[model samples]
Target: MSFYLTALLQGLCFSGIALGIYISMKIFNIPDITTDGSYTLGGVVTAVLLTHHVSGYLILPAVIIAGWIAGGMTGLIHTKLKINPLLAGILVMTALYSVNLTVMGRSNLPLVSISSIFTSLTVLADPNQNTGLILLVFVIVITLLIGYLLKTDFGIAMRATGNSESMIRALGVNTERMKIIGLALANALTAVSGYLITQFQGFADMNMGIGIVIVGLGSVIVAETLINWLRITSVWISLILVLAGAIIFQLILALTLSIGVDANLLKLVTAVFVLLIVSLPRLNRVKD
Candidate 1:
């Protein structure tokens, strides 16, 4: 039960990444691999600030700004330099590795000795339960904010830019500008995951963001599956489904571990699981 509970907390921590991916991949139709780098950047920034005795709430803006800059760089590279979006993301992600290391001044920074945002809350007696409750609130607020954004005029334009770039451009919408802004927003959200996860795990490592985009991809794909199956057109309902997908993805992994799968093979399991999720829909259509 405790194990499953921990997974639930982790899924909540990862809500930012799922939403980020939904923006980049679902909204903008860009794979935007900058997620791996910006995520570590968030954790790096959070760790540095916390060790300096900065207030937890104060660190959020810093983290978001840092993420925004990283994402903006990728957008600029892709739009201004005429680079492929994937390559631009890869370039920024690679650069962020060194940036994260320089920010940390080491390979790892431990936060267990210091206070965390989770520690500040005292509503629940059990620390785990308290953390879970706080995370639930955090996820809800973020989801609501995103849902509202997607229903606005700018948001509609952003979605249209993705759905029909040529058509929107015909209407005088600068498709390139939209792509840049969309990527920037996506990575900023991704960085928040790093902020939350570093505090949750009580440490920040330079390598923490390695291949992390897969988690977001898996979650978004899971949500995408449901969105298709239910024909969900409401943006708010789709956002809620994305949150559910993140939780469900983590729970599946937890179940795998509980059934005695080798911990070292977990990545392999994740890969296979994602492949199945990605393939299943196509297989169903083919059968019909």
Candidate 2:
């Protein structure tokens, strides 16, 4: 039960990246691989700052800014330079590898003796419960803000830019600027996940973000399936579903591990799970 509880907390930690992928892939229709890099960027930033005695809360702004800049660079490459979106993300992600290593000055930085955001406040008796509560509140706030943003006029423009770029551009909206802002917002959220997860795990690894994008993509795919099956149209409900998707994804992984699967095969298991989720709607359509 405790193992599953920990998995649940981990899913919450990943909710940020899941939401980021929801915005970039579902909303913007871009396969922004920059997530893989920005996620690590967040962790290293947190690790470095915490080691230097900075307040956990204070470092969040820096993480957000760093993620935004990385994402904005991808957007600029794709839009202004006329490069492919996928390639632009790849370029930025590649560059971020060196950047992360340089910033951390080591491949792995442990926070074993360092205080983290979870330690800043403790209302619950059990430490796990306290962490869960903190993550829940954080996720809720972020979801609300994103949901509210998507409902505003500017937010609607961003959506329109994604749904029908030509039409939105015809209406005098600068589609490129929207893409830039959207990617920036998405990666900033991804960075927050890094911030949370590093604290939760008690260390930051240079390769921690490697293939991490798949986690977010899988969660988004789950949310997309739910959205289609339930015909959900409300922005708030859709965002909530995305959070549920992240938790569900992690639970599935936990179940796999509990069943005695080799830990080394976990990545393979993840790939297979995501493939099935991706194929489900198509399989259903075929059945129909």
Candidate 3:
């Protein structure tokens, strides 16, 4: 039970990153790979700043700002320079590799000695509450915030911009601005998740974000699949599915770990998971 709870909490914490995927994939109809690097940028920045006595409060915004810049670059490359969206993301992600390394002041950073946001929970408990509560709080806040955002006027405009960008531009909506803003916002969320992960887990490896895009997509696929299962065709239902699916996917991973699965095999697992989800719909259509 404890293990399950822990995994669920962790999943929820990381769901911010998954939500980023949701924004890019479902909202923007864009395939963004920069998340793989921006995530690490968050961790590295947070870790480096905290090591130098930077407040967690301050470090968060720092990480977010970093993510925004990275994502906006990707958008600029795609929209202004006329690069393919996917390739633009790849270019930014590749560049972030060195940037994140610079942020950490080293190849890695460990937050064991640094007081993390989750550490406060122990002051009110048996001193062994772990980081689950911290994850829960963050997840709840982010989920509510994002859900609200998607319902706002700006959110509507943003969604419309993604659906038919040229049409939006024709309506004088400045689709390029919307795309850049959405990408920045999406990646900012991802960076927040990365910051929390590093703080809670006590380490920030430069390569920490490898396969992260796949993991984020897997979480979204799981979320969307569950939404579909519930016959959910509305945006509200879609939001709920995203959070629930993140929790569910984490448990799925936990189940694998409990069965003595090697951690090294996780990439392959994520690939298979994504492949199945991507193929399932098409296969069903063929049968139909």
Candidate 4:
């Protein structure tokens, strides 16, 4: 039971990254690979600040800003220099590896003795339960806020820019600016996931963000299927389903481990799982 509970909490920590990927890939149709680096960047920033006695709340904005800058750089490279979006994201992600190392000044940072945002919360009686509650609250708040934003005028513009770039551009919308904002917002959300995971796990490792994009992509793909089957039209419901997808993905992994799968094969299993999810829909279309 405890193992399943831990997986649920970890899934909630990853919900933010799923949301980020939904924005970048689903909304903007951009294959932004900056997630790998910006995620580590967030963890690095959090570890450095926490170790230096910085307030946990303050670290949130700092991480967001750092991620925003990283994402903005990718957007600028793609939009201004006429580079491919994939290549631009690759460049920024590669650069962020060195930047994260410089920020941490080490390959890993332990936070066992340092205070964390989870430690400061007094609402939960069990210390083990505090992290889960806090993560739930964070995910709920962010989901609602993003849902609300998607209904706003600017958010509609962003969606329009993604759907029909030339049409929105002709209508006086700055498509380039919208793309930049979308990417920045996506990366900011991804950074928040990194921040939460680092605090929850009690340490930050430079390699923690490796191949994390697959997790986010898997979650989004799952959510997309749910949205279609459920005929979900409300943005809020769609967002909730996306978060649920993250939790479900983690649960699947937990189940796999419980069934005695080798830990060394976990990454391979994850890749195969995501590949199946991505291919199934296309297969159905072909059958139809």
Candidate 5:
């Protein structure tokens, strides 16, 4: 029971990343790989700030800014330099590795003695429940905020720019600016996930974001299937499904581990799982 609870909490921590991926891949149709670096950037920034006695709340905006800058760099490279989006993301992600290491000044930083956002929250009487509640609150707030934004005029413009760049550009929308803003927003959310996970796990490792994109992608893919099947039209409901997908993904992983899967094969399993999700829809279309 405790193991399943832990997985649920972990899913909440990762919800932000899933939302981020949904924006970048589903909305903007951009394969933004900057998530890998920006995620660790968030953790590194949080760990460094916490160790230096910075307030936990103060770290949120700082991590968001850091992630925005990283994402904006990718956007600029792709738009201004006329580079491929994938390559631009790859460049930024690779650069972020060195930037994260430099920021931490070490390969890993443990936060056992440092205060965290979880430690400061006093909402729940039980310490065990406090962390989960706090994470749930954060995820809900962020998801609702994002859902609201997606319904605004600018948000509609962003969606249009993604669906038909030339058409939006012809309509006088600055498609380049929209892409930059969208990527920045996506990465900011991804950073939030990194921040939460670092606090939850009590440590930040330089390699922590490795293959993290797969987790987010898996969650988004899962949500997409549910959205299609249910014909979900409401923005809020779509957002909730994405969050639920993250939790479900973690639960599946927990079940797999409980069934005695080798820890060393976890990554392989994740890859196969995502592949199946990605391919199943296409196979169904073929059968139809």
Candidate 6:
């Protein structure tokens, strides 16, 4: 309800996007254009279940599993069929539109009186107190846990799979498995974010996921640019950049919305942001 609390919720939105981008781009190197669809899939799953009186905790995992399947489908198509990774993602994303439509049984799903994670976790809080702060805390904790997971051996293998699948394979690692696993983890997180987004925003449009991939990629690129500019080279630094990028992305969106920016233009703005981040190194001619 308050300004600060709204700002925190906005920040958490970006944090979710950043974490999704990190998993798809950084860990998997899969260039997952399918995220946009998987995102909506999560929302649709949550909304459908919530509409059917599913428990909040149960819906969380359901949406996550739904996301995993969506992403893993892309991985399977790419690995088994040898489709171009980009094209594979596109195909999966296309299929998800219909799937999302089916999940909602038409177009969009609404959470009229669903109990969200925040509502359940805030029983002790003042009825008027800010719940966004509590929700933001959980988002931060999830982000930190994801970062820690990426540091473990499994995470190392996942990262390595992104850069050089052959190298990881030669090292006795199952690169294909890692790719599948990475997509599963990444999309599951996206799904959870979508689930949270639906609960937080109180509605889920079947098409709500459009442009989300670009937004997530933009945040990741912006974060990477910031850290690379500073010559930061640690995994921790990358994680920080991911979080920072997401926060900054949301701030930019909020600012744009406050200035009465056209809703459609926001998609263009996201594209431009990604272009800027992707092109900066070449423009400066000093990428490495």
For lDDT, the strongest prediction is 2
Provide TM-scores for the models: 0.98, 0.99, 0.93, 0.98, 0.98, 0.90
RMSD of 4: 0.9
- Against the unseen true structure, what C-alpha lDDT does each candidate score? 0.93, 0.95, 0.84, 0.92, 0.93, 0.78
lDDT of model 2 at residue 21? 96
RMSD of each: 0.8, 0.7, 1.8, 0.9, 0.9, 2.6
| Residue pairs in collision within model 3 | none
What lDDT tens digits, residue by residue, belong to model 6 across residues 1-288? 253445457556556667877888877767888889988988888888887877878887788789889888888888888899899989999998988897689886767767766676775556324456665666768777887988899888888888888898999998877887778777887777788778778889988888888767877888878877898878877877887777777777667666787877888876776787798789888745
Candidate 1, residues 1-288: lDDT per residue as tens digits? 866988899999999999999999999889899999999999999999999999888999999999999999999999999999999999999999999999899999998779888998678999998998888988999998888888998899999999999999999998888988889889999999999999999999998898789999999999999999999998998999999999999999999999999999988888898999999999999999
Please state the error at residue 194 of candidate 4 in Å. 0.6
Cα error, residue 117 of model 1, in Å, equals: 0.6
User: Comparing 2 and 6 by TM-score, which wins?
Assistant: 2
lDDT of 5: 0.93
Tens digit of per-residue lDDT, candidate 3, span 39-70:
99988888888888877877888888989998
Clashing pairs in 2: none
Query: Clashes in model 1: which pairs?
Result: none
Stretches of candidate 6 off by over 4 Å are 1-8, 123-129, 286-288
lDDT of 5 by residue, 1-288 (tens): 776888899999999899999999988999999999999999999999999999989999999999899989999999999999999999999999999999999999999878898998688888779998899889989988899899999999999988899999999999999999999999999999999999999999999999999999999999999999999988889899999999999998888888999988989989999999999999999999
TM-score of model 4 relative to the true fold?
Answer: 0.98
Tell me the spans in candidate 5 whose CA falls farther than 4 Å from its real position.
none
Give per-residue lDDT, candidate 6, residue 6. 52
> Where is model 6 poorest over a 10-residue stretch in terms of lDDT?
1-10
Give the higher-lDDT candidate: 1 or 4. 1
Give a tens-digit lDDT track for model 2, residues 228-263: 989999999999999999999999999999999999
* lDDT, residue 75, model 6: 82
In model 3, state the lDDT of residue 180. 92
